[model samples]
Target: MMRFHISYLACAAAIIGAALTAAPTAAAHQTTHQTRHQTTRLVFPGQSIQRAVDAAQPGDTVLVTPGTYRESVTVSTPGLTLRGTGRETVIEPGTTKAADSCAEHGNGICVLGTKDRDVEGVTVASLTVRNFTGTGVFAMATDGLTVRNVTAVNNGVWGIAQERSVRGLFVKNTARDNGDAGLFLANTIKEEAGAADTQGTVVEHNRLEGNRIGITVRRLRNLTVAENHLTGNCAGVFVVGDENKPRAGALTVRDNTVADNNKSCPATARLEALQGSGIVLTGTEDTLVTGNHVTGNAGTSSLSGGIVLFKSFVGTPGERNRITDNTLEGNAPADLVDTDTGHDNTFTGNACTASRPAGLC
Candidate 1:
């Protein structure tokens, strides 16, 4: 009886082993119906960028060879990476300008995102965009977008702009001679939606020069602008509240070389009135401008200084804005300018050559 029981247990074990061995084969057969992923599409000069974009799928890369292509490309596909061979690959807007490109601004490269369609996880790298009618690279309503190693020169209004986009990264790019801010970020969502605070936009290790403003951040939360060389612009960095919402803050400007921003602005109707300053904080709260080397940003206006803090009627006062640990030297008029309305704004541990509100250093 013991031998019979042992034989029956051995048979049951053999059956279980057979089933386990066949399960993987069955799974592989079922997965055979899935489509194969598309490979990288190599595009030559004079090829249509839009065609390659249309044919690309998620996880596919469209790589353009080194040359000049006169085309305005629109990328609405998610998870697509459009990379050029190098800075020699220039993309110019084509002859027939689309009146409706880039939200009617007519951009060189537009990454579109909306309620129905979401264009997230897109990357534009290693290209030069010049002479576009609108922004060089415009990304709206996107998430996880990256723009790196690109040269945006002489674009219409902005060099690189992100509106209502979250988790964006703009690094190692050069934005020069743009009409407006070299790098811009703002929110398009209404404040009532409670999603106005788009977080984690990083602008680092870039050169912003010869623009209206070096860098501009508005209606954004948790922004980090660090280690950038902002020179020869109207303003080094401009952080302020938007006209409609007027309650934007939580910015960090540190470790930047803000110098020689003595550009002239003659009461322009459109340009930033506060020019020739290293860093300007208007209507902000809970901000930090620290560890920056600010010098030679001199102009005749009071707004031209090492750092200026003021309050606009657009939002709350400039409360709790700390300006500390910065190296301020030889700025015109004063090293620092503080208005009375900037309540609770402190300047401690600063090495300034001179200060407007004297003896604050």
Candidate 2:
């Protein structure tokens, strides 16, 4: 009986030792899996920026050091932040030695955030994005994106293009001398056809200069554009909505200094057609253009005005707009033109340097 009890005790001790040994292996497997799923940070020293972005997981930060990275990048992941150590971190398109006939297709930074998952905390800050074959920063179908303290210049297309159902903040950025509009916001087919609204985009406190147009908006709702310095461009702000789809909505343009926008030289007459006026509102409703200093926007061939309003194609008169308390001067032709297509649009207390007939005012 003593021998049998000792044998039983030894077997039990062996079983306990096996359990103890297996516990650490099970725990290690779990820890390894969790580490794989955790947010990762990638540092780019001499490596390519695209490679770093490709290796980054969701919720990762790609901290780029000061260097000129000549490559176009596309980020499709959600919750990623791509930031530079300073404004000196430059990213541009790779130049090709091929003939100019070859069509180039790439942007400095392109974010295609289209999943049902929210693409939150995608911050791009303190970088210089330039000379891209496409837009400098293209935010398409994204939400909760932020761009700050960046400079976009000399792009083949728009400096910053926000399309589809993009809701985000664009602040303290400079866009200059791009081939297309400095900043453009448009609704894609998905947003326009779907029931969801592109309602929460804010463009503020930026400097736009020497572009075809400073800012252009189409088929957007509940947008605010204020306190921006738009100068030496073709036009300051162009707000037009799709009359066919009938999606024009509320926009507030106030407290901005729009001046000297049509500054393209006569030698660039072909390019001057793209220049913008102080403010051009077409086929839009429920807009307020007030408290702005609009001046010195002389179009290349035609007379430019501080504000030009046109009727909707659906024969609905442009209504419910308030043009008040704006200092309008130095633009060609007149400070404001109603075109007789709009009705019930009031202009009160607006200081206009160009005199008009009593009824026109």
Candidate 3:
């Protein structure tokens, strides 16, 4: 009787194993069907990148070869990838004016989606976009947009700019010598709006230098700026806010190297003269600044410091912000500063020598 019971148990185990194996087999068949439909279109030098992009369907990739192409690109399709061979695949301005709406707007590449719907699952990678009057790469109303391994240099405005986008990943890219921030994300650039929820957008593992600011997070929420190298800009990172509702905050700035942001920028119409700011946060709430290495940023500007909490221009003060666990040195005026009248702001566990109000280190 014991042998019969053991044999029955073995049979039950074999039945369960077979069922599990069969379920995966069916799933594999479905996955194969889905993967079979994705296509790749190649574009060479002297070819129209926009034409190839327009001809592509959803789940298509437009791969460009290593050459200099003088045209602008606009991508509106979901589940699309626009990848280049490497930095050798350069995009410059076209010969004539009004090449397209993107070129007409003075942008290198534009990923445009409507106000009502988001363009989802787009990827732009491995290219060099330079010398545009406007932004190198621009996006709006996008979901899950990934811009990786791209180089943006010497643009008149921002190197990489996005608005009304969520779930974005900007990684392993280089942005330098732009007029504005190397990477700029905002709720809206022209209009006044409340903060927009980014739904876990991440800017990580990039290098930003020689711009007005390294990275700017303006009026955004639920995002992270991490693990980037920022130098030679007027400011390393700027988390900007104003008197708008649903205020801009709830983001993380962590594990970055912010150094030597001492370039002088004249005052713009909306901003003060900028220099030597490592990480500046104004009019934010519930923000976390941690684990950063800030050094060699020295200037006498109003926003100058290793880490600062200055008064916002629009009368909204930072509240519930936490500055912790950072290493700061060689910053002028102070290594830490808090000049705003904010509530629930805390500074602890930082390795710094000087602070404006004292004891912040």
Which has the greatest lDDT? 3
lDDT of 1 at 197: 65
Candidate 1 least-lDDT 10 residues: 25-34
Q: What does the lDDT read for residue 215 in candidate 1?
A: 93
Candidate 3 lDDT, 1-361, residue by residue in tens? 4453334334333422321111112111111012357755556565688888897888887777678999899999999999887798899999888647889889999999998999999999999999999999999999999999999999999999999999999999999999999999999988999999999999999999999999999999999999999999999999988778899999999999999999999999978999999999999999999999999898899899999997678878999999999999999889998998989999999999999998899
CA lDDT of 133 in candidate 3?
97
- C-alpha local distance difference test of each model: 0.78, 0.70, 0.88
Of 1 and 3, the candidate ranking higher by TM-score: 3
- Residue 123 deviation, candidate 2, in Å? 1.4
Ranking by TM-score: 3, 1, 2
Candidate 2, residues 43-147, lDDT tens digits: the string is 333456666777777877665656787677777778877877556788876654322221245577887765555555577877899987778998877887888
Question: After superposition on all CA atoms, what RMSD does each candidate show versus the true structure?
Answer: 13.6, 13.6, 12.3
- Clash count (model 1, backbone only): 0
